[model samples]
Target chain A: MKTQKYIVIGGSAGSFKIIIRIIKFLPANFKKTIFLTLHRLKHVRSGFVEALSLKANIPIVEPKDKEIILTGRIYLAPANYHLYIEPTKTISLSTEELVNHSRPSIDLTFQSAAHSLKDNVAGIILSGANRDGAEGLKQIKLNGGFAIVQNPEECQVLTMPTAALKKSQTKNIYSEKQIIEFILNCK
Target chain B: MIKLDDIINFNNAVKEVSSYNLSDYSKKSLGRRIEKILSDYKMTIDSLIKKIKLDSNFLEKIIKNITVNTTELFRDPKIWQSVKYRVLRKLKNKDTINIWHAGCSTGQEIYSMLIILHELGIANKANILATDINTDVIEIAKKGEYIYKFNIEYIENFKQAIQVNPYNYEDKIDVSFTKYFEIDRVKNLMTAKPFLKNKVVFKKYDLVKQDNIFAEKFDIIFCRNVLIYFNAKLQKRVVNMFADVLSKKGFLILGIHESIFGAEALKYIKHGEFYIRR
Candidate 1:
């Protein structure tokens, strides 16, 4: 049985609104840990958590370094650093050089989680301007994890999903509404 | 497919070669590194095991890449400003100061601290103890030579690193980067002055399961951005060790995004983004 122990959703540019809509549907009793690795300016102070928490039934938090990763919760990567899921299931943040000109790069989180969690990882790629998550989503599939990419035709920017499609062997292509259903089904 | 047995053998091979235990490091991270090394070098786990046994220098290459974390100069500048206004200024009258920098990768923060002490004119009175687990990084730290930073990147990092100073933002006073750094714009190399490097004693001490190397109690300890690699239990153990070595008024600093939570939080008193031993 392929149990979805971890769910990581990634996006950039125009994916925030879609994420909020998706997050709003996840129940508080969801049995897996969820991570949101969205692209944002390192210097800008964003109210992302406060905004998401208002609608999310489950706890939505911007993780502090060394913070424990609990089940049934949502974690947003803070800006300006690469977020890693350590073996102990705690969070490790690295300000290492940016990949694809972005810190909190979706690829870093997705790749780390895929390596650490292995087959238990389920990844979803959303609208983005870059190809960061493409390789990582492919890595997830290589590690025996499941992958879903938002249909490029439905995305605000098609490059990210299109790039992800080139690498990932996913049959679970879905629009925004269907992606929400896929998330709920994982629970 | 990589199985649990492969991971166990890899850790055993690492221990046999380096005499350092990788058993306690997060298996997830270790696995990631192992996977990367395999693909990058075109070797399977079994071949890598053979390389570790036959090749003497193989372990060193893996260890160096494993321990490196992101570090920058005067990183998270608000913390420096807080140190300046709250901690250093309060201790200015002291005849001597002891500062311990744990996991001081390549001495960026050490130079940054030296700059702060120099700006405060207390550089003469302070003795800094800087250490990292990596011997190579320690050697570089001892030299105190930094390559020049590009202006655009430097300015961008500076803006993000520092919290806007109220008066400086209002009055538009700019920071003169040259005051603390000796920059050779032509040679594209910046070397930290001798006065700062002279005061620092660099040692190789492992924070995890290592014997005590530091005998002197410190007035300030900078253990920033290192603990995130460890699990919660290890984080507590390391922080408690810091507390044991700290003086009553000693300051303990963490990364901008790290916190002193749980029972360990009781040992420190928070003061405007800085923490002091209670």
Candidate 2:
């Protein structure tokens, strides 16, 4: 059986818009599992999942630990934990020290996916504060996986994505609409 | 007996030193620094001068070796801590935030920021601008990829290296920030994603040469590890440009070792990590 492809999205501050941009482009019938992570306060319940659910026909919900990642389902990391995709496509949670001072670090997700998912991974880093995903994206590209970063000009918060752009090399950088178009068009 | 002629020649040499093309740099400071280098290398002044003059490629190599890239993912942990406590506090209320990565070298720092912001539940609002002088480097930066090497040190200090949060209940996220990476045969070759596509903009810019920036203004300007390349005068000049182009209250972040120092650049402030405001 051909392994399923994983689409991972990570960001902060301006990330909500970034996720919306990509999810909007995905048709309801799309079959890929889309994983989303946005950094926020660990204690506070993020209404983002609900907010995004309104716009996306696909199931948009926070990922539960050990949950088997299903195709066409969108998994969002809960606040304050670095999210990872296991080889079994299960979700792993950690309270370990923060990379870039973030628990649910974008780099953590991207890096883990790059290792576990290999060629089936497509990692995208959006707007954020520091250079978290820069190293993770580098892994994706080295492992022969596709990687993308939002054009900082089009990003709501340019630091995170710009940091990524500064540190690692990427295949392409596109604006929000263009990113959406590319993701949806992907076979 | 003191010779007036010799004293006159010595004075002229001092003036000549000041008049060189590198006058913009503080001679004594840089001279002392280079002298230290010479001493460390156990080379006499004569040999050092000969080494520099005799081989152009060697000179280039020396300069490249000394070039302060001073970079890493989440360079200054305090900066991330500060952003988490201060900037992110405000970010929680906002729907979006835009940031500019100026003088981004291969792209580690920006991705570090994205990881933090994503953890903060604000990744969707991110807008990133990555600019640099080296077109070749910029092209590489756009790839958002890396090769990896696994080291026991990296594994042991993985938590510290990544700055992951240690407090989570219920669905604890277990992304082994270090396990994601494995060592390659090449040294320091990291395998990972640098940034997300559709989240960042990469462009070319020379802070010294450019007078105007046609691109969109930024909410935050990250010129980290870039100012060290220029002399104080050039640093001031670039600082002015950054101030002119930045939005009001926009943040300006520099390298941990770098500072706006004497420049009337931005309203320099000591936040958790060093930051400036226009």
Candidate number of the best TM-score: 1
Overall lDDT per candidate, in order of appearance:
0.80, 0.64
TM-score of chain A of each: 0.95, 0.92
| Model 2 whole-model lDDT (C-alpha atoms) | 0.64
Q: Model 1, A1-187: lDDT tens per residue?
A: 5768899999997898899898888887887889989888554545767888999899988888778899999998987767887567888786655778888888889888888889999999999999989888998998999999999888999889989988886777899998888788876
Assess the local accuracy of residue B258 in candidate 1 as a C-alpha lDDT between 0 and 100: 82
The CA root-mean-square deviation of candidate 2, after full C-alpha superposition on the true structure, stands at 24.0
Per-residue CA lDDT of model 1 for B13-89, tens digit only, reads: 87887766666665555665677778878999999888887776777777666675566677766677677667887
Task: Output the lDDT of residue B100, model 2.
Answer: 77
lDDT tens digits, residues A64-180, model 2? 444578888899876655577767667755433466877678887887788778889888888887788889888877887888889999777789888787777774787888778
lDDT per residue (tens digit) for residues B1-278 in model 2? 11334333322433343322223332222343345446667776556556755665554444333323334555545466566556666655655577878877777666667766766678788778787755555665666455444323323333442454433234344556533334455566654443344577788765656647555666677877566445557668777777777666667877544556565733556564546563
Per-model TM-score versus the true fold: 0.82, 0.43
